[model samples]
Target: MKMALSIALLVVMTSSAGAQYLGNYSANPYAPNSTGNAYGAGSPYNPNSVNNPYGRYGSTHSNSSANNPYAMDAPKLYDSQGNYRGRLSSNPYDPDSISNPYGRYGSRFSPDSVNNPFGAGNPYVPDSPTNPYGQGFSIQGADDD
Candidate 1:
């Protein structure tokens, strides 16, 4: 019985660890380093930011998939004016997302919006459920110290 309890405890711990929000840096090379799992300043949930542990997803970039080989099927594109350009044909967040796997909302993962900073006029609208900052963050006077 003791052995079974230990095994169960181990499983629980492991499962929780997997669920921890660590961002998706190492998982997707094509993604910017800002939204990755690295812990530090400029991170979306830097404990210092208005939104602590800024969940795991945030704003996306327009040129993220430019040179990406898996740029296809990532997200539709657009110009600064929000014009519909085209859709990505590659899968950046698949489980096999090795090298350039797609992230949660099909947009390249970033640790937070601060680090990545998706410029204005991004045209990719995430069809998935993980896109939190697709429209971008606009906290006026947020920096008024």
Candidate 2:
């Protein structure tokens, strides 16, 4: 029984670690009309809603806010296959933000950055939002509706 229990614990630990490396498997916060989008604003009073200026995730003064430069919990972006892309932030100072031109995932020269015309930003890529001629693009993260 002891041996079985140990094996089970090991399995659980391994799975949890793997999931973390792959990124949080949550709904796409960047999706059009999503709570994170300015256009798809959620309840104006919901703490996590970007529409709430006083909310933790919405307040510019909060460390976890998407608008905060020091935010550590900015909404993450994931591809349709659940691949971890990066943080979906407009803060130019956040190292993980896709808007940071100097960051790995945000650099226009970086292959993973959406600003890279030859890479993730390519208009020909179906998943690229820059692809105006293609179907709508999608990503994952943020508070549930």
Candidate 3:
């Protein structure tokens, strides 16, 4: 009897581990991180939100999906029913998320990412044509202290 109990407990725990990710867009649907509230600064679907320990599955029409400007260039993925599954890598809760494989919403995955921080509008990029302060800095309030 003890062995049977241990086996059952192990099965449950193991299944939950694979479901560590969170979001409606997750490939796995065992335990969806479902929420009626809109995704944003403090909602479940918000990729920037943390501590989501379950499966993910976001819809394309979700508030966060429609509002976040970052999704403009990011790739989009969908489910069988085609219900706006979610952006390619927009979930921040799942570290191993297929959508967010590198996690951090791909914070360092692309040229525009903070890790690289260089592109059309990066002010720090001296060679970028859109850099407003490329080679010059006036230090507007340096002496405010």
Candidate 4:
């Protein structure tokens, strides 16, 4: 009975230890060995990888609430430094916002930065007669006799 009791205690302690993490940490900065705690946020892209397009970690707000590319409907806005800016509806991606210098898009690509004053959703537009609104609907003028 004594042996069984000790073994059970040991198992319980180890299990709990594995699920524990160091204190004094927030989900803002992510850590490789810092799991079990929901306090760390992952870098927008693999900061360690050479192919990683995101700028230097912690330099461009990697912990931003709007930079969740892992989410179901993540936006594709990246800054000049290649850091994730934010979504179109978000401030960082909005031309009206003081933070958005490149306009709607986070990058310099014309297609992503163009602002559509006459549309909704994503104001970034081609504005051509063939396809003025990328995803937004269009309006027709009344016919005259």
| TM-score to native of every candidate shown | 0.22, 0.57, 0.24, 0.18
Model 3 is weakest, by summed lDDT over 10 consecutive residues, at 136-145
Candidate 1 stretches with Cα past 4 Å from truth are: 20-55, 61-145
Off by over 4 Å in 3: 26-87, 90-145
Cα lDDT of all candidates, in order? 0.30, 0.60, 0.32, 0.30
lDDT of 2 by residue, 1-145 (tens): 9999999999987665542221221223455434434444344565556456787656778765656776776767665555666776668887888889999779999988878889777777666646543322233334322
Q: What is the lDDT of candidate 2?
A: 0.60
lDDT of 4 by residue, 22-118 (tens): 1111111233312112332232343321112362221223322122232222223333233333342234544422235566443334333323233
Model 4's number of clashes is 3
Off by over 4 Å in 2: 1-47, 131-145
Top TM-score: which candidate number?
A: 2
Query: Which ten residues in a row are the worst by lDDT in model 1?
Result: 136-145
Sorting all predicted structures by TM-score, with the top scorer first, yields: 2, 3, 1, 4
Superposition error at 61 for model 3 (Å): 25
